[model samples]
Target: MWERQDFVLLLDLDAFAPKDRVDAFHLALNDTSVPNDVVHESPEKGIRARFETWRVGSLDLFDVRSTGFEVRRTARHVRRHRERPVVSVSLQTMGVHRAENAGERYVLGPDDIAIFHELTPRLYGWSGEAASWAVTIDMEDLGVPVDTVTRASVRLRTSPVHDLVLAHLRTLRRDPGGLEKDPGAAALGTATTDLVRALLTSAAHDAEDRRVRAVMNDSLTQRIMAYTRCHLTDPELSPDRIAHAHAISRRRLYAVLGRAGIRLEQWVISERLEAACRLLTSPRHAGLPVSAVAARCGFTSPSHFTRRFRAAYGVTPREWRRHRIQESSRTPPDGPPDTIPPTA
Candidate 1:
């Protein structure tokens, strides 16, 4: 629901009263996904910080031009985390900036793109007034592993594909309203996602045959797993059915799964079990019967579901649900939940 809503936020320190500028800037940055502390270095020049953000489709397009300031994410901050995972692609358009992550440092200049994982402890700063345009990629929408995305980030480099992505971003920024109003906005958005995925994939590739095959297989596995997840309730979700849907031979599909050290049937069963567990633990489905839960997760019979559930989890379905309820009651309201629902 939030994704469908279109909004924009623009903040300029110069527009605010001298007394309110610092507070306003701090509040504004706090509202963003990449929250950070802002410090004014030169008291005489004041701080020249301006930020504009547009939420278009799955991407958060950010245009930031700030005076010399430092943004730091400390280990303490990581412990009290509030933000979800996001990959920031910084396109340096003006002055240079330095980024430090895991003891590695990178200096980026104009036309150079650097990627950073927001959840990773890092520090970035620039001297004088540095200008840059950043595109924030939602971790969930990247269709790849967070580790893979992180590996492709925070590097100082230039490429033809990077130039193309920058061009598309410039067009999107110039006429955001027009693009949003167009009928092909969704398609264009998808194109941008694919472009970003391609950029990352290309950057992380190697010349070795084994490495290339591994990369291709990993991407294929992610796509197949995503498809299976969406169609988990389908009773006919067999390896043959998946192969047909993806236009790949069944043998090839088996080989792909084999490379990932998983069997097709095992993957499907695990996804179904995860879905059933999720429904059983959810308050919304509290009144749903065990048979209903089993049927919803593609099980043909309640007894079969119970047997498999107990075998995999070392507990019966009812016992598992009771345990989850008790645990939830004792845990803090804002505490993190267990990593269930199984992502591939």
Candidate 2:
């Protein structure tokens, strides 16, 4: 099973005695990753390894830096440790790595990426000091057939989607701590899954397959949602501009989002209202006037913004900000303030 950890688990072999470091590192792997046999290449020289992992929504993001070692997952291991199938994509950031799966073998260098499945027997290892960033996703969540994933695994470099997905993973690794605390972390995980599905669809030879086409359509919808979120502050973020930016017809965009139950205008307005609410209550934006806040949140007119904000939140923006200020004044630094009784 994929371990769900909200905090990072770091294991540095230097903290253990030379004789016990290898064993400790081995045990750490079993706890954080799949069950497998770990063998250090030169235990006599002492093992230098560091493993860190944390969860991002349903995805497991990990980083490993170690001296020469080999990890073997045999048929026996798979049978004994029966768990949900997962696919792992790893990007080699340093040194060389080798992977073998189902009789196909590949050697990867810096910036190269490889994909492997947990349900299959495999061998993965590297010599000297090597580092990599990887993410594991459940097969059910990936929404792609096992055959499709396997077919695309070896040919990922052939498609531009490969670099796009790689860049996303790099960004996740760049600031994992910040990402873990982000409210949109779950959305980011979903976006990663969608990008992987797109990469698989593009790399696989069976692009004409029915299921592949469905995955592609779903990926487009996700892309639209992500793009909209990023451009929420732009006043020109309309259906025509969004559709044109994605190179899809306005009708096609509507069809995709409509099937997903998203009304473009309503969703956009709600998002803007929420943005305005956040800015109005923030101390950093306290000096700004309500009209300025509305304008900054993509509202062309302060009157329209007030109407929508009041309709959605049951109070005017100024009242909401004043209430927040009052609440802060009543709150003590050491403890939470007593709950205010509801007014009749």
Candidate 3:
């Protein structure tokens, strides 16, 4: 039987008759998403399983606890779910979980996280009493290319962000009710997306196959831009630090960005200048001095900041602020004000 409470859904085999448990479980899973073949290790002893699911924004979270069972998704199943692809990140909480996908076998113990794609054929099972929590994210929402995901799937632990992401997932597992009731669940979902992107980007960079790495360089360029934007206020942010952070050589980093036509230092300078412009026009920072705004946006010197700001926006910071203020007074109360365009 399936139970629904608000946004959460639960299916407990105990609620079903002994003869109907397996079929009910299969049907429930098939109804939710893709189809899979489920086989209990000891049907005579009866199946004891519970599945609970809830949504955190665009990500769907699942908690599955069972005695022992095997679930297999064949090529036929992949074909059925081809149009709607998803990546699942599963964290084993109790007992051992084993998976075979893409001609590779993976074993995960308690606290281990495994990432797999639903578009691929897979075999997953547990031998004894096992419990796991997983989150399903649409590949489109995940923002990583499928090839990069497939390559990073096997090298997740290599990323420096892996442990941080693992901790975050653990926290999500700890508070289902709080997540459901929280108004900021959407923001948390966005943060999860960013963390997962960072993890996969870093992991994919560690791949040994140079051909695959080269193929993923374009995705890596985007990750680098995102990482740089987040660390714009850090004075220590540099190509060496960025390269080390992503576990790639500095030369490789330059080459990747070069192929993408992104001048690293110039891009960083433009981003900082853009940030300064936003602060200059912001009402909250209305009282902040031009030099203070520059410092806050990662410019080391006031004169250097002024030169770059004028070069990028054709106006000094003070002039930009004065112009915005004047424009704001003339605009209708409900109308949108013009924004400074980003530097190229």
TM agreement with the true structure for every prediction = 0.54, 0.66, 0.59
Ten-residue segment with the worst summed lDDT in candidate 1?
A: 335-344
Which portions of model 3 show Cα errors greater than 4 Å?
A: 1-7, 207-344
Candidate 3 C-alpha lDDT tens digits along 6-118: 33657888889999998888887776668888888998888888888888877889988888988899989888985768889889988888888667888987656788787
Error of 3 at 36 (Å): 1.2
lDDT of 1 by residue, 271-344 (tens): 78877887787766778888899999998879988999998899999998888867766766566443232211
**Which model, 2 or 3, shows the larger TM-score?**
2
Local accuracy by lDDT, each model: 0.68, 0.78, 0.77
Clashing pairs in 2: none
Considering every candidate listed, which one attains the maximal TM-score?
Answer: 2
The digit string of per-residue lDDT tens for model 2 on 260-301 reads: 898999999987886676677666577889999889888889
Order of quality (lDDT): 2, 3, 1
For candidate 1, give the lDDT of residue 278: 71
Which candidate do you rate higher for lDDT, 2 or 3?
2
Better of 1 and 3 by lDDT: 3
